[model samples]
Target: MPIQQKDPSRASTYSWPGVLAIALGALSLVVTEFLPVGLLPGICRDLGVAEGTAGLAVTATAILGFIAAPVTAIAIGRADRKRVLLGLTALLIISSVLSWKAESFATLLIARVILGIGVGGFWAISITAAAKLVPPEKVHAASSIVFAGISIGSVIAVPAGSYIGAHADWRDGFMGASVLAVVCFALQLVFLPSLKMKHGVNVRDFFGLLKDPKVRAIFLTVIFIVAGQYAGYTFVTPYLEQITHLSTAIVSVLLFAYGVATVVGNFVGGAFAGRNLHNTVVATVWIFVLSLASIAAFATSPMFAGLSLLVWAVSWGMAPVGTQLWLYNATLHAPEAAQAMNTSVFQLSIGLGSLAGGIAVNHAGLHSSMWLGALILALAVMMVYIVGRMNRQPAVAA
Candidate 1:
């Protein structure tokens, strides 16, 4: 199906074909990035390792994603964006093929590191490239449409992998991701319109964006929220089985609820942030704290606990988009820098949170970890709000 463009500026110059092609391009890259998460259970069963160890496969991606993303963003900043995107899509396809053939956990982990490189590089270009494809007024809308690919791919890839793991081979799941990348690559070559980019990008120019207090604040806020949220989430399924007394099926249902709520919260957070970035961040962070506390307090109550999950689910949704918007607004003219910084911050948060969550799990108990997460989110709210007030933006990163 062809995408329909409404604006007059969106003629053949940067038609709907170019725009939607770019969006699907983002979707496929993100699926490749996150495929390991969906593949975890199967990998663990096959490798005869614990689920946490399988999660290391996922962590490996982030560990590499943070390091690879910024460097690639700078190296490719001056290149033709479409060509960079096309190259990354090709790399993603190779990752899928390699993942399908891995004989051991180390091989799989190495494959994931490669995928991480492609994932980070793909994101570093996609949005900034898409923004250039259209008129200035349509940049935000275009960027959102591109981001929607990530959300949609996230929602799809896990279930798709889970189903393949149940019925077919785990290898098939990876191969399928590769197939998707091929289709996206074809679409990009066919429909992506050429456009001008801001040139003369140097390492020093990239570093300059980091010095801004607002940019640093937003980056720290993302690191805080993501690290805090995932610390609890990484250990959640085990907690549910041990502490919440839910069966596997019921746990699936709870996870389903959380996933659905997160998708909902993502769009809702974007809407709120568009109007008042500060208020939205403040409101969502507090809601996040309150919800985590509620879930921890009522861990045993299914009905109440379920309600708490929904609230927490909403928080998960708000956190990503809110943070991204904060960074974009912070960088102003240099949106690519914002994107690169957010990617790094997000990965760092995951690495730290997972490490911290493990320590908390070993020392305190699953339930106590949730408390730590809430405290961290509370701190993030404080950091962003205080920064916002100081900058006189009032809500630039709230």
Candidate 2:
């Protein structure tokens, strides 16, 4: 069944504080999700694991997140969304503390598994929740605000984790993430309103969405794009260190620069997607192909490499919003179910991408993963174009 549309008049009042709390939740989850990327070396050293093995820290979260997204969506039917979000936020705090105290790789992976559930459930509901916080006209803007949290968290996680690992310890980074989650929980507890579901989602609604070709295309594109992005990105630090021969400080700075570009790209993509999602997605995919290829082609040149990273970051920032907008537009009737599938596919792709990249890194080399990513992203471009041709609907205005 389609979700009952809320009265437009009632949705006119924007709940900025509640939206910010959701964004904060996004930030906290993202930081925990990607912290292992930056601290892989330290984790490897401490846990007596190889670089490829340590990357499983990310994979663990992605895999669990993949499972959790749809499960949470269906299970939480008609429950208070505010309470669900708060409970998820609390999970973040628990996971972070567990990560901070982890004595072995198994313990850390267990903590990441917990974090994955929070990440998946939070993402599945966040965009829909944000939509309810504003007038229908401003839903795109509200969704962008939530994505901005993702970009901002990326900005903080990698560089800050690197800095902390260099000066203090990698474990401290998890502790910091725990503190951030605590803050997000408090904010949400205060500001977020009771959001009762008008219609409960079910398993059939999830599978029902797959019948739409446009929806399938969007999920396929997400799989390709996200998988490709993570494949190359998961090992970026090692690439910078070994291939570029950069010090920890310079790598941290470069990662910070990449994060900033993502933030700028988020809003830019959101703006363009609102007008023309097809073009925005196509352009972003092209950038992904070029940037990942460039990163590989110019690995020896720090200047070229950094420039490519910035460009790639912008495309990365643009990607989620554009694809997400496309998905929402395609499945307006079953938005929650569609978003759950989106979150699931997105996280599944991350897991597969990182896992593929790990296999490539272990066998072939670092540069191979970049080339592989570029190739997969090239495929994404074609998929997006095909989807555009299949669905010639008018663009939905923000």
Candidate 3:
């Protein structure tokens, strides 16, 4: 069934107001989701836990997202997405407040877990709902636009919060996120056009995705791309400082530069993804591999490594999202499930990448880690090719 979209803003040339609203929702999710990563040192000092223990603040949310998103997608079909988004945003408010007051690592972890449920539920349901906010022809654009928010929010918000924590306090990050979540919630309540799914959620719908070849390929691709970049990205500091022998200040500047490059990639990837999602994903994955390999091979070249990191971050930004739109295209019937599943897969990849990076960094030199990443990205690219083959339909050519 095709979607019905009301003409709204210029951004919604193909979408409705709900797509923009969902992007707002995505902004909140990305901030809350990556907040701990930025504030880990502060959280550790405040809670009197080791940084590793404080890191669980992020782990808890990610684990919860993995556990909760799929089921939420199945259970919450065809409901009022505006209500759903508002409810999740309210949960984000509550969770952020809980995180603000948490005194112990365990308490923070509990709060983070609650935060994860809100994020997981929102990601799973919101993108599919955004798709509904646009006409069928414009579904790709709407979905890509919402996903671009995550990339923008992650690269921009996490760093800003980290800067705040460095200057003021870690709790300030949570406080700011709470205020933003409230604003997002209120905006959704006001400006978001109401929408309903084309059909109700069925138990059978979940099982049906299991039989699809495209789902398997997409799942693999997500795990691959995410795990690869995360492996290097999680340990970019060591790569810059130890491998490249750059000073901390210079490394930070380069990292900030890399982030800026990534934001550029997000917009470029979004535009291309709206056209041909599969080809865009494949191209991004390969570029991702080449970028990682270049850094690993030329670690002593700081200028070259910095340039490679820029490309790497940009391409890394592209894959998680570009593939998401690809998954949306593949699982047209269960768009919610596809979106939610991609979140779960990508979240799981974060955990996996971090763990793998830690292990590889400990056992071998940091230089070897990019190879490990490149290996995974290669697999992800392969999955893209295979899935494209699997999902290939007879194209209507001019």
On lDDT, the leading prediction is: 2
Worst 10 residues of 3 by lDDT: 6-15
Give TM-scores for every candidate, taking all chains together and pairing residue i with residue i: 0.85, 0.91, 0.80
List clashing residue pairs in candidate 2: none
Q: What Cα-based lDDT does every candidate model obtain?
A: 0.73, 0.88, 0.74
Q: Compared with the true structure, what per-residue lDDT tens digits does model 1 show for residues 262-318? A: 899998998998898778878899999898888789988887777988899887898
**Best of the two (1, 2) by TM-score:** 2
Clashing pairs in 3: none
- What TM-score, to 2 decimals, does candidate 3 have? 0.80
Among these predictions, the greatest TM-score belongs to 2
lDDT of 3 by residue, 1-398 (tens): 99967433222333455678779888888888777765655675677864434445655677788876876776767676667788888888898888888777777778788888888888887766777666678877987788677767877654565566567888888888888888888878877766555565566766787688767777887888887876666556546666899865576567667767888887788888889887887899889999999998889998888888889988976765677666767688876556666777877777677567656766786776788888888888788888777666535331
The candidate 2 region of ten consecutive residues with least summed lDDT is: 5-14
Residues 187-268 of candidate 2 have per-residue lDDT tens digits of 9998887787677679999889998878888899899999999999998888888898889889989888888888888889
- lDDT sort, best first: 2, 3, 1
